[model samples]
Target chain A: MRLASKASSPPRRRQSFTEFLGRREVMPFLLLVPVLIFFIIWNTIPTLWLLGLSFYRFSLTSGRPPIFAGFYNFDSILNDSAVWLGLSRTFLFVILAVGIETVLGLLLGLLFWGSQKLPGRRVALTLLFTPMVLTPVASGTFWRLIYDPTFGILGSIFRGLGLPSLNFLGDAHLAFGAVLLVDIWMWTPFMVLMTLAALASVPKAELEAAEIDQLSWWQRLRLVILYHGKFILMLGILLRTIDAFKTMDLIYDMTFGGPGSTTEVIAITLYRRAFEDFTMGWSSALAVILLLISIAFTATFIFVLHSRDRKQASLAEEGA
Target chain B: MTTWRRHLYHLLLWLIALVFFAPVAWIILSSFKTANQILAVPPVWIFRPTLANYVRVLSDPGMVHSFINSIVLSVTSVLIAVAVAFLAAFSFSRFKPPGTNFLMFLLLSIRMLPGSAAILPVYLMYVGFGWKDSYWALILFYAMFSIPFSVWILKGFIDGVSPRFDETGRVNGASWLSIIAKLIFPQVLPGVIAALIFNFIFVWNEFLFDYIIGGPHTTNVPTALSTGLYSGGGVDWTFVSCVTTLYILPPIVIVYVFQRYLLVGMTFGTVRGEV
Candidate 1:
């Protein structure tokens, strides 16, 4: 069928020498070329350069060439107390936020899928969707106000309940949780949207079959809905993981890397090192490390997605 | 389930929705309070509403200029992105261009590289060309980043459009441009609208690029509010809330109007890929 369609398609227009100069197809590429070249030169080159610079004794100010110091930067970061602290905090934030978002997202998706007949479904979704749309700076500003230790809404609420007041941002432990809380609050809706879309696409007859088979709600979900939704859920988790790692704006505004680097994720740490501390070389090294980590995470996701896809294909063939 | 269980579900949904919206609700409420009253204990649920902060911001000279700059930058960049993506999508869908898939993969991969990673090199290039603080530098860069999404989504939309219409136009001796302007344009209007709205929101929400490139003098609303210039620590909390409300207005309004299209556009190929 694909071959038949391709054969019947119109012959693609060839470029005549004189008219080629005036062709729209060529025009499109001509316009697109400079941008592509610019990305290649600036974006692609600098990214690769960071890998090289990570090993060298690089300096931004002196204009000295990067010396091949052979993993000195990596070794230093490994040995440094602050580096371990930042790495662990970053991992904790990602795990906690992704974990919470996945559970909450599943629950919300169930609610959305089951509550389709409910009135005000759209209204509920619109409200739930608002936070995800808000810019991180705006969210940060709003949350920072709420985090005000003495006079904030949170404090006032706790006081009213006769509970001990908490310094959400001022304290170290709370600061980490506070950042993770904002992340979960902001992104859980995204997870809900993805999972809900997947759930909505679950084969209805199969679900009904499960229902007729005397399966409980949990069984129906596990056997029918989840079987179909698993790949998309994996996709959602992988996307969120990579994104949470790169999250910088909210962290910057909310904590400024905090009461002393308590909430400092890699992005925040890299920004401070490069901009505030003026250690360009070290910052570049940190940036490269973050890039590699994200790439690895995404690659693993692709592998999982592909395997799931293959499994689904076989399942379809067997049923047929 | 009984009626009571149904009511409980409704209540649970309402509570979840309220949790998601509480911060926004707080900002809107605080916008109406006086500076001193904003921090009032028990958080004044009922109080005399005031537009003093809005009045102050509206009358401020620099604030108005920054607002204009924000609107201009966002609209212009989105326009450029949508226009470029439109042509590129047309070329891809109609004429199978050389290396099209690779080109698309390359374009989408730009999104994977974090904005921070791109900033250092792009900044160096801009500084080299003495384009720092120039509107063109920021607009061009923003449009470049915006293309991947516009292309991906619009390509999906265009793929749904049949090629018979193009053949019909060709049989009638109509040129490709005319056919696109008339036949394809009308059909994919929703796609165009969705892309425009998404691009607008994306550009408006962008901070890292705006902060790094816009510098101190050119303050986008997010940067201004974020780096709130509380030199002596007498921060205007109410004013900040008011600023947040105003900053959020454009996206909210756009999203509200075109929400159905937004949903379809975002979920298009993802769910429907099989069917």
Candidate 2:
């Protein structure tokens, strides 16, 4: 605040353009302009375009001007079975992926955290983080091969064990589960990392006190561990939810909404409309919905980060 | 802890690590096998290695072009993003105006706009500007996407550094730019490097914008691997193996090199604790 005031303090004399631009108040805003322009052009305008175009019927290939159809797209969306199907599938994917990842992550993370005395722990952590860093397309593409009924290693192993060689990705009933497994495989490490971070936020004194008080394991976990790690866990959940909900590239590379639309999430739906069918206006309505949902998640994410930041700052102030 | 329990944890850590790494190992091993060997019924556990796959992928001009393009675009965009994000982060950390937090949230909301949601509008906008297949479009857009994340991470790092450094630099008659570059930058170099590494991995891995907006001229590795060369003949296991192995090598090295900082980088600096 002091700096903010000094930055805005009145100038005594006329200054050159460069000097004015270099002024404390001016420079920060000046530094911001490039990024500001970037967002306006890339994000803001396009979102406005998405909102506006959703009210009309427009196509890329029809060689026709947009025909205004007020509430038609939204009205149609209300009755659109594909839209409903995609949303339901997407919600299912988000829930299953996020839920499983969180549980697995917590268990694995607790194990990793407790194994501080374990040799080669650092190497294990590095290896565990490997999958999360790989390109989703590459991971999905490779996983696609791995799920092949004939040539895949998994298939061969399955046959060797006297089990049927099922086409993991080709079967409608199995495709969603197969994709969900890969999502878990890829993202579980992220959850683990977040879990560790959350646990790190738990003050050691509190844990020692809990131990001295002889609280039951569940009581300790529920009252102290979760209570402290809640925000970070929520942050992780929000992050995973958004990413899982918007998952397209992995699905695109894998089943591609195959086996009779069994795995078609909303992201894939949006891709189909905009790129495959070239229905710009119709997809915009869908985009608007996605935009809103993501905005809500982003709001929560920012709020969590903001509140945690403030809490940390206040804690530091007290320590000082 | 009991000795047996400690030993059990050791086994568990090794087992977990191996399970996580098996897929990656399989992909790499597949790259060294013949097409027939790769598809063997029982799966070839021990095979005579060959460089034939690498030879084929590398000899292809298209693969080479896209791979180089991926490096150039990713490195360039990440560098630009780091520079701009650093400046902005420094400003927000030091000269934070009123409602800065609100503004920052709005900035990040734009950042969170999913690619598919904005694909239509962005694609249309690119078409309007004759930017499809343009180098500047990708370079700029990649930087744009990376900026918000970098700024967030760098801001956290910059916040950790004391304001006394700023005052000292000012007292030394240094300009703000110099103070940023000479003083703050060195202090936050780790954060900068973290941002650079992760951002590079991101752009390198990005598929959609490159595949849709890129043409013969601008195709990056992901775009090429998906729709262009390597897989042009339709899903060849040997082809995928070669491409995946070569493609993932850089990321593998990076993750290993920055193993300690991976958490901070991965979490966008929300986790500042050392590994």
Candidate 3:
């Protein structure tokens, strides 16, 4: 059948020299070469350089060339308290922020998904997404203002309610929580948007059949919504987790990883090592570790997505 | 659902929207308040709105310079990225070039790496080559970073366009460039616009590269706002609010105008990919 259809398509034209140069196969390569070259120069070379730097000891200001130091940088970083703290804190922040955002976003998505025809939905969506779209530095600045203990709105509200005002970015735990709040505020809309898109795409027949069969709310959710939305939800979580692990801008603007390094994620630590401390080799090792974690994440995500797709394909075949 | 329950749900949705919007609303409000009123203990709720903050921020040559830098950097980078990505995406979609999948995976993995990972080496290279603090440094870097996402989005869009369009153009003796440039490009223009908007916003909001590599000549809005507000002797609430308000306005406007494409673009076309 495929061969018959392929044979029925338009025949190829006579090839002039120019046409041969612009052949369908050749043209794509021509168009893609610039981008590929840019990628190689900007991404590939730098990445390889980073790898090489990770195996050497160097400082930007030392005026000495990098010296080969086989695994020394990695060994020191693995044993460094600050590195461990940053990694653990990053994991904690990702878990808490992404977890809350996902749950809240799912609820909001369910609510708004059912209210597509509601008046003001457009305005509400614009409002909801405003946070996500704002420049992170700007958002961090505004949030810092809002969290100001002296005259910020949150402080005023707390004090008005007969509660003592809490220093949001000054204390260790509160600072972490404050950062989590900022992340959730910025990203929950992402969760909502993704979830709604997934929910909206659920086949109407499947939904009607579930309803006609009188499935309870939980069962309907599990069998229909969850089944259909699981992939997208997982994709959302995966994207958010990876981004959260790289959180630096907001932290940099808000606290500079301080009140003592309480909120320093790996990105900030890496930044400090390279920029402030000028320890190029150690920073490169840290960067390599970060790259490995990100690769592990992408691999896991692709693996899960592939398995789920395969499962679905088989189930569809069985159904047919 | 019961009528009251539905009404309650709508109400809750509105409340959620408002809660999400309150911080931004506060920023906008603060921008209009007096310096003293901005830092008022009870948080001045109602005050006569003033244009003083706008007037002040706009009057600062540094602020104006940063805004121009942001516009130039973001617009150029986004345009370059979109053009490059469109060609690449077209090639991937139509030709299904050998190693295309692997190439795409490599690109996506590059994006997955924390941008900070590349900053150290790139920074050193830039300084060594005398490219640091130059517009090309930022423009090229931003364009490079935007390619993977742009390619993904544009590829998804191109996939939606049937191959028959190309064949039709060919049947009419149209060359490959004309088929892609004239026919395919127009069809995918909306996707291109989405990618453009997305890349523009990403570059505009970029902080790390701008902070580390940008200097007096090339400091974009985000970096300027960070240093301008925080590095000074005291936190001038009014000035900070004013600058931030200006800083966020462009993206806010873009987001509002293109909210329809927000999910697909923001998610790097993953949700659309599912469809």
Model 3 docking grade: medium
Superposed model 1: Cα runs more than 4 Å off: A1-38, A45-81, A298-320, B1-8, B92-99, B167-174, B261-275
- Return the TM-score for each candidate structure: 0.87, 0.94, 0.94
Model 1 chain A scores worst on lDDT over the 10 consecutive residues at A30-39
Question: Looking at candidate 1, what is the lDDT of residue A289?
Answer: 69
Give the DockQ (C-alpha) for candidate 3.
0.63
Interface RMSD of 3: 2.0
**Model 3 lDDT tens row, B20-78:** 99999899888999998998888778889999889998998998999999999999998
Candidate 2 local lDDT, A131-241, one digit each (tens): 988887888889987998988878988888899999999999899999999999999988988888888888999999999999999999899999988888888888888
- Score each candidate by Cα lDDT: 0.75, 0.85, 0.86
Cα misplacement distance, residue A32 of candidate 1 (Å): 5.0
> What are the chain A TM-scores of the candidates, in order?
0.85, 0.91, 0.90
lDDT of 3 at B70: 91
Tens-place lDDT digits, model 2, residues B1-275: 78897788789888998899899989999999998898888788998999999999999898899888999889999998888888888888999966678767766765566678857788878877888898888888888888877988899899989999989988887878888888999999999998999888889899998887777888887777677434455577787789888898888888888886777777777666655
lDDT at B157 for candidate 3? 91
lDDT of 1 by residue, A19-97 (tens): 6633655755664565465456645765666666667776666677667888788777778788778878878888999
Clash count list over all predictions: 0, 0, 0
